[model samples]
Target: MKLAVLATGNIANKVTQTLVQIKELECYAVASRELSKAQQFKERFGFKKAYGSYEEMVCDPEVELVYITSPHSHHFEHMKLCIEHGKNVICEKAFTVNAAQAREIKSLAQEHKVFVTEAIWTRYMPSRSIINKVLSDGLIGDVKAITANLCYNVCHRNRVSNPTLAGGALLDVGVYCINFALMHLGSDIREIHSTWQKIDTGVDGMNTISIQYNDGRLANLTSAITAKSDRQGIVYGTKGYMVITNINNPSLIRVFDYDDKLIKSVEVPPQISGYEYEFIESVKAIGEGRIESWSMPLTDSIEVMTIMDQIRAQWGLRYPME
Candidate 1:
């Protein structure tokens, strides 16, 4: 697979590096809004070409997959262009600013018969699935509650705090919280009640979301870009509970029982900087002519966006396009 990376930012660099780790894949090119930035990425990564615009990157005939790494606002346009040009894509998370835009782009990909997926690396990891299996086997007994908190002092003015860039702790950090909860608790969210405190940029700096699952389980979730936290998340039940330290990139699942006895402390798979599993799954699926990933299906991605949309609406936060 000849891949054209859509940005030169931190995540873009990670995606490119991850792709390079695969012997079957090649980073054909890298692109950034700034020509110098693109050249720098190409030089560092040894990519074949660099482009100042995403249009040029997508138009490269040698580029089979366009890994979009731009900000939220640019994802829709860039991915749409790639799909239109018959290139499959793996877009950054929070798939789009809204579910409406995400659906449109996905439909376009379907029409073009090109696979498009959200780069939710967590869903594709074997460690994640193993933990899921443990939970599914009732190793934790009847599920009770989920507690997810992700907080790191994003002290700087990041897009997560800027409305123009679809920034917020919810979209930036809390989506993973939501996804984590939904994963163990299932997608049928019974009720959602949330509160937010805005940063200087009019987007949420920190927020707490209370979700009630249809199965009578509760998810108490919180995210913050202005504060520091342990970043641990919990999933509980009548029988036992699973404690995942650092919900976003979990590397441990500690199970405890009703009597507070340690059921097991499972050592997760060794971690990698860029998360190679998701990219590997993308290559395998797309190479097999599959349109959606079985691990994180298109419907689930759409549902995640829908949940975010409603939460943002509740917070009275609107993006540039909205």
Candidate 2:
């Protein structure tokens, strides 16, 4: 798989580094609006090619996959360019600014017979897989409830408080909370109630989402840029509970039986920030002629976006040109 990453920023760097780690995939090139940035990245990552424009990179037949690592507001445009050019895409989340944009991209990708997914690396990580196995084994019995807290002291990232950029904790940091709940509990987000701490840009500096399911299962999920919470999550059930420490990054998962007895802690590590898994998955799915990923389908991405959109609407958070 030959992959070209759009935007030579932080995430683009991560994507390229991870792509190189895959045995079959090559980080063919990197492109950014700034030509110097792309050139610098090529030297730093050893990618053979670099482009100042995404369109120019996508036109190359050698590029089998295109990773859109642009800003949240620019995902739709970047994805459209890649899909229209007949390139598969691994997009960064909030997939798009809203669910409506996600729908548009999905339709285009399907019509083109191309694969597309929110390059939400965490969902495709080994830690998530390990936990899935534990849950399927009934180690936690029937999942009764879930609590996730993801708050960090991102004082340097004013994007959370920048209205012009749609920088909020919900889209940037909180997306993981929503994805974790949806993965463990399934795609049924019946109702969501969210409250936020106001940022300088009138967006949420910190927000907590309460998701209720049909089976009386509820998840208390929270995301913030104000201060660090436990940065951990718990899935509880009648039989046992699973504890996920350092939920935001790659880490270990510990399962406990009743009376808070430790069942086991799976030590799955040596993963590079866990972002590499999603890119590799996209390559496999596309190679198999699949239009969507079974692990995290386009519909699943839209469902998560729908929940995020509703949460934003309830909090009076609106992004520009959305």
Q: How well does each candidate superpose onto the true structure, as a TM-score?
A: 0.96, 0.95
Every candidate's lDDT: 0.83, 0.84
lDDT of predicted model 2: 0.84
The digit string of per-residue lDDT tens for model 2 on 244-319 reads 9877774879999898989898888787657778877888899899988877898988888899889888987788
Which candidate comes out best when scored by lDDT? Answer: 2
Candidate 1 — which residues are off by over 4 angstroms?
none
lDDT of 1 at 222: 93
Tens digit per residue, CA lDDT, model 1, 32-143: 9899999999998889999998888877888888888888877888888899999988889878888998889878978999988888777776667768777788888877
lDDT of model 1 at position 10: 79
Clashing pairs in 2: none
State how far residue 275 of model 1 sits from its true place (Å): 1.7
